[model samples]
Each structure stands twice: as C-alpha cells, then as structure tokens.
Target: MEPKPASASRVEVTHLVMPGDANSLGTAFGGMVMQWTDLAAGMAAMRHARLPVVTASLDQLSFLAPVRIGHMAILVAHVTAVFATSMEVNVEVSTEDPRTGERRRCCDAYLTFVALDDAGRPTRAPPLLTESEDERRREREARVRRASRLALRTALTGA
Candidate 1:
C-alpha cells in the first residue's frame, strides 16, 4: 500500500452544544465529547486506510476543562501512526465561546482503529507519511504508547 500523508487524513469537526448535550450543571456531558472525538478519529482513520474502520480501543483520554452549554465544540483529529491493520488517531477537543471568541482546550484522546475489508476482517492500512517535525514526533510517541498498551493488554489477558 502506498503511504499517505498525515495531512491527507486530518479532519476537523465542530458542533454546537445544546441543552440536550449538557448535564444538569450546564456543562456538556463527558460522553458527548467522547462521542464527537470518536467520530472525528474514526473519520481520520478511514481516510487514511481508505476502508471501513472500527474503534479498537481508547488508549488515553484526558478531560482538562468543561464545555458549557451554548458553546461550540471543535474537534481536530489526524492519523499519528499505522501498524499493519491498525492505526492510532489523536483527537483534540476545544470549546469556543461564540460571544468572546475565546477557545479553551477541553479534552484530548488517543484511539486505536482497525481497518476492515469487505469480508469484515482486519486489513492492512497504508503507511503514514509524516512530513513535518511535529508529525514525526507524534508518530514516535505513538509507537511508545502502542508498546505500553500492548504490555497492559498482555498483563490483563495473559496472552
């Protein structure tokens, strides 16, 4: 498979936080943000793989701030690295105040996705082409994270 540039699979999505997405505290629900992140990450992974992809795991997630109702939630996602049939995606979530135009990072997450073929089996994904230093750094870090995740899984499953 031809290597695809990370820029080619980058995705940015925005959503307005409505009452339905908020909790009794008037802040957007954590699950809502997670859903948006998952969608954005999935899109990036599919773009990179050029095939249907499924979420394998959420390797890391951090909630730094709360997004209030009536704010705009912005999510940016891109492929960090590709490992055979699986790829890692990083998503950053921020909340923007429509009136003040101020943006605050609310959350960030790393998710793993597996590309699937028409037979619904895992398929190889294209290699990631990291052109910039930041991209290269992210790819390197992703490899370390992957190692940690694999160790944890082995410890838990004894496989």
Candidate 2:
C-alpha cells in the first residue's frame, strides 16, 4: 500500500450523565458509553461520507476511568480510514466531574462502519480529506489498529 498523505474526519458530542445511565457501582455503565460512542461515530461517518452508515464491527473498547452520575460526558469520534466499503471510526470518551469540575478520559474505542445505499446495501464512501499533521498521525494509528484487528480475526477464524 502506498503511503499517501493522511487525513481524518471527526465529530464530538457532549451530554450530562444521568442516574439512569449509572450502574449499581454508581458509575456509568460500559454499555451506555458504548452506545454513545456508536452514535458519535455514526455521526462522524455520515458527515464525512454523506451517506447512511451502519456499524459493521467494534474493533476494541477500553475503559480507563469511571464516569460518575451527574457528570458531563463528551464523546469524540473520528474517521480513521477506509478499507473497501468499511470506514474505521476511532472514538474517545471523557467526563467532567460535577464535584471537582475536572475532566478525564474514561474510554477509547475503534469501530468500523459501512456506508449504505438507498436500498440499505453496503456502498462506497467518500475519500477522507487529509490536510493536517494531526490527520496524518491518526491515519498512521488507524493503520496499526487495522493490522492488529486483521491478525486477531485470522487467529480466531484460523483462515
């Protein structure tokens, strides 16, 4: 693969964490965070590709910190790359504590989505515009993640 100039597309959403999103441990549930991640990533993909996109895979999700109820949760997502009909979405989750007003990263993840046609079948997405150093760096990181996921799939499927 030729190394072209890298560029990424990104978006962010922020909302207040509610009691309904918390678990028995008094922290936001993993599933709830994952849900917001998907939404943010989908929005990013749609903005970049100008099409309806659907989740094809969630490559990985890691929880680094806890988000308490009544905190402000911010979800940021970016389109890291495109492989055939699939686009990789990298998402970061952060939270601002209501008590201390301090912000911290709570989760990070990579998700893959496929653009859909009017008929709901997989379709090609627009190429990402690379225009900055940050975009290039993200593309490099995406390449590494793509390789890792490929290796993992091969190991699991033995194919």
What tens digits encode model 1's per-residue C-alpha lDDT throughout 48-140? 999999998896677898999989999999999999999999999999999999999998899999999999999999999899999999999
In model 2, which runs have C-alpha deviations exceeding 4 angstroms?
1-9, 154-159
lDDT of 1: 0.94
Model 1: worst 10 consecutive residues (lDDT sum): 56-65
- Model 1 segments more than 4 A misplaced: none
Kindly give the stretch of ten consecutive residues in candidate 2 with the minimal lDDT sum.
1-10
Clashes of each: 0, 0
| Candidate with the greatest TM-score versus the true structure | 1
For each candidate in turn, the TM-score is 0.97, 0.86
Reference-based lDDT, residue 144, model 2: 88
Report the C-alpha lDDT of model 2 over 75-144, residue by residue, as the tens digit.
9888878776678888889999878889999988899889998999998887665667787788788888
